[model samples]
Target: MAMVFADPEMLDRLAKSLDSKAGAIPQLKSRASALDAGDHVSGLPAIASWLGDTAKDLRRRANILRSPSESPFDSLAAFGLPPGVAGDPDAGKKFQTELKAILEAQKNGTPQQRAQAVKDYFATLSPAQQAALAATDPLLVGNLDGVPVNVRYAANRITIQTEYTKEAAYLATLKPTDGAYKRTQERVDTLRSFLNPRIKSYEDPKTGQDMKIEVSRQFLVFDPHFGSTADAKSSPFPDGRIAEVVGDLENADNVAFRVPGITNRLDNFNGFTNGGYQLAADPNGNERPDSAVVSWLGYDTPELGDSVDPAKAFAGGAALNAFRQGISVNLKPNAGLDIFAHSYGTLVTSKALQAGLTNVDNVTFMGSPGLGPNINSVADFKMPNTKFFAMRAPGDWVSYTQGHGKDPADFKDITRLGTDGASGHSQYYDPSTGSLANMRRIFYGGDAKPLTFTHTSLDDEQIGAAEAREMVGFLHSKVPPEIVVKMGGDLDAAVQAHFAGRTGVKDLLLEVHSVLGKYNMLDRVPPDEMFGKINDLAGNVAYKQTYKAVKDKGAPDFVAAAAGKAAELASEKLLGAVTWPVVKLLEVDRIANDAKQFGEIIDRGTAEIGGHVRELGTELGREGAQIYNDTKELSEGLFKDGGKVVLELGDTVIRPWNAGQNAADIWKIGDDAKDKIFAKVPDIAGGLNDVKNTVVDKGGDIARSAAETGGKALDKGIDIGKGVVKFFGG
Candidate 1:
């Protein structure tokens, strides 16, 4: 049967004509009443009464034409179809015809208009009617934006099952050698995978235990075509666009759309969906089980070469914006919406934002090359209340390319998070990483303090210090408590005095070099060898000055005096071989050897620390210079404030250094590096304990300070440009 719709414009015109005719009835009735009074005609009164009744009927008919029935069935009732038409055999066909007509009328309308039309049309259908329509024309209702999500889920499931059966049957009829058989089989398998719920396993970050989560699969947009010529050749993908939700989107408190980038296809849908599962998982650390994640492969992602083009991103952005609109309307009240975009997907998201995508609470870009060439600032995006966040893990060189625009990490409006446990471009969603943890915090609407990028030097210094402490603790375990009590006291004091003397030597040498450099006395030094030469000259000067100072104060060298005492003891033992001096001489020799080994260990540890510090300084210096060059016109104050933060955090290194030293001091009594007694030394342990407490307290202070400083800078509207002053420590 052909579909037909009543022309709303024609009805409107007819209503107006009837209303105009009805308006002249009152004048006609008045003229008739006057004529009856003058002529004394009894029948004129009846005529006037008849004219008035006719006018009321005309007005009633016009009202009906002006306001059509909200329900399609009601509209059909005026055409002689009863409300009980559901019992009639032809009613389903009639209803479908009318619904199709309504849909056709809205075909040329805007997306929102069409959506509203679909929403209103569905509101008139009974549950049984809806189910029947979904069963008969699954494709029509499945991809419609304004259809209820639950209904769409049902319709899409039927579509999936139908496509799977068709492909599977077609494949079985073809021989293995047939060119189409493999692709058909692959499609069948892909469709079949979505038929059942999937169980995913992830590690709970807080408890460090493996946990399992099961998620229902709902395909909002599923196209089984693999872009074979037999299918639609004009389709963008070799495999069709897909969007799979990992949980109940309608009921979820939080919904995150995961947009992937580059080389994504139906073949990788399951892998992409795994990221959705990770987002949906609610570990005990931050329990938010009422969450859903959508793996939205709604566009043909570009391959590596095609990634440089913005055409795909722009097109994908339009589709994503429409899809998000559908989601926004169907979502439960007060449910938060967020976008987790990666790589080129960040570009896609930026385009969507430019296209007026709204209602997003947060947007996170991980390892993004750029937003786009056109996106110069956060103001370019239409989202007003949305919080923007970005992260680039160490060695994620893709983000540094800045191929699209400014790196998001360098965008002042974007809050940069740490990626400490993640690496490269793909590990942002890894459960063990701080990147994922911060993502969860944002998704769950928790308090997420921005984590600073870990400076390489600080990380290296901590690692070295930890290793040194562990070695010291092991040496302490090998030492006999009795031996340490008998001879360790004097050795400990000598070691402390030696460390104190060496501490000022390095500082004094550095000070002398700085003075020379300031006065241009080192101008003739070759740039390549300047540092080595300066260290040599400065060290010699420092040594002479220190010798003079020591002589003036008559200070004794504790380590040398200890060695001299040992020699005297050995000489006395040689004269009294049968006496206690023999045993004493052995103890003295052993103590000297242990002390020498301790000094060597400290030297190696400090040297490693110094190397790391130098590397860190060089890297930071380059970064600071780059920042200065980038933001010289924006704000010098930002660069200065950032430098202050770095210097303040640099003070944290002393805590670990002190811990290492205390561990060494009490553990220096072993006869050899390996053979030693395990005993707890209270004084050294107490000192180490103090350092540990201080480190924790200082770390908290740094976090608070960074947060405060960052907040203040943002509040002051600092135009950071490409020079981002990241808050470090937390």
Candidate 2:
């Protein structure tokens, strides 16, 4: 939790410590250096000696035991008096007075009060302090030329290692060394540890095995210019030629996809050969057979400061499509796929979904400023059914500086790249603490311990949850196959409808299909059982047809009424199957407002197909009656066997979807019987025409209904494809 500032007196006490003096440099000539004279180890002693004497430096510097070599600023050149408060005089006086009081409160304040006092001091310094601090630390400030830029941390202003000793001297003069200064010094160390990056190993309580994690060292290439492929035949691949690391074929269970951001060319591809292989190599120095990571450095864009050009189609999407095609050539279905995207790589994720590639599971984003507002939820950014993860350390300044005035939904915001948003743009390693734990948890489940400074721990569960939601959610990206088939069917309809001037219907179908396809009925389902269920259902249909036909024949005015009733029943049955899922899916909305709005859409689709099927059946039955009557007049023998007569009449008067094939050609049939039926029906044009129309109409209805229903479920599962082009169509 962040500290709040309300107390003025407490802030004054803290102000006293802000102007403390630096301690004298240690006398290294008197003590023996702790090195064995080797070049690598020779400098260690002198560095250690300087760290021992910096306790009296400015509050920020004193807290850090800096070695001379590691000293960010040269002592003589960088040291300066605390400049008089530069902004508002009245506010400065109030804060200065409050700062001293806060120092006293540190000795006698409640935890809450003490926390508030800390907040007050930081609040007064905020934008100005941040700028000043960044001005001094080379890591934080890109270029120093009169003006200072405030490098933001996670909602806090980090202290810059400056050369001001007056701030250090003033604090030492007011309070004893062991009093407030000591405690504040300890807190400063804690803050540093929280922000520092480190690789650590810990014993897992669950597996009781030592687990190791390294906070990745982030490499920021400041504008390594890469021109278009058309202009340059070969772009420089950065770092070096990458090693094969873990071969794609070796990872039977894992598949990795890498996305390089703007101005990427050869340099971005190093992860595939070097960084990826290094990570894939086991501690014993062998390649793991279950995983492989691939780098995708195929994209084009303007420089960092430029806005994304809307007119141009980004190359990453097409590259991913090509990659998917190549991968499918050898990879088994359903392998877990992880996608790593950095900076502009996030925009590639959006395009991947727009294209037809599937089976993505995880996506991770790093060094991104913000993801656009259109991507309000993780679902909006991922493939129909993929998990997404986002990682950023506090030290990375791009997350804050990039896209400052742009809309939250603009692609300029990299955080939106995750299924769940990654909040800040940060260096992956600086401030070895905080969000690093979240990134580790995404790759290897469970908490990573926060780096401890002298007095505090920096990382916590809240940040962990945000990271987990983004990463783990990415793992769930691939919707189950059954759901996909259904969604795909509906998507096909949407595409067809869109081109045919049925945009409204297309929109509805898209919505419905997306949600319905997500329903996972596999918990206890066996693939082999589907046929058996269909068989049982078919038998029930046959029994009802026979029983109703007989009962209707014995009743008054049975002929016309019987056919009408049967047509209505078929429509009801078809509609019921399709409509039920829609209603049920919509009910999820009532339980939670965020529930996907696809149910009603699927139901409407069911109705359309159901009504079509019923109308076709009715029309066929009417035509069948006319054929039976006309044929009977030609020859009484035609009506002799009622079953044969009915079959003949149905074939001639009904036209069905995919009904051109003879009975023998459709389902399994006896060769002898198949021959006899075909010979007897030779030149029986009317019967064949009738059945073909009926079958075609019914088949279309079923395909449409299934597509609508399945698509909706899948959309719900992945939370994508809602309104499609409509949302951004213009």
Candidate lDDT (C-alpha), each: 0.59, 0.40
Q: Using TM-score as the measure, which candidate wins?
A: 1
Q: For model 1, how does the per-residue alpha-carbon lDDT over 226-338 read when each residue is reduced to its tens digit?
A: 32222221111256678877666778998999999876777556766666766666543332457888889988776543466677799999988888876566778799999
lDDT of 1: 0.59
lDDT of 2 by residue, 136-172 (tens): 3323222111111112221111222221132244334
- What is the TM-score of each predicted model, taking all chains together? 0.46, 0.27
By TM-score, how accurate is candidate 2? 0.27
Candidate 2 Cα misplacement greater than 4 A, ranges:
1-245, 248-250, 267-274, 278-287, 305-307, 310-313, 381-384, 401-730
- In the predicted model 1, the residue pairs found to clash are 477-677, 478-676, 478-677, 479-676, 479-677, 480-677
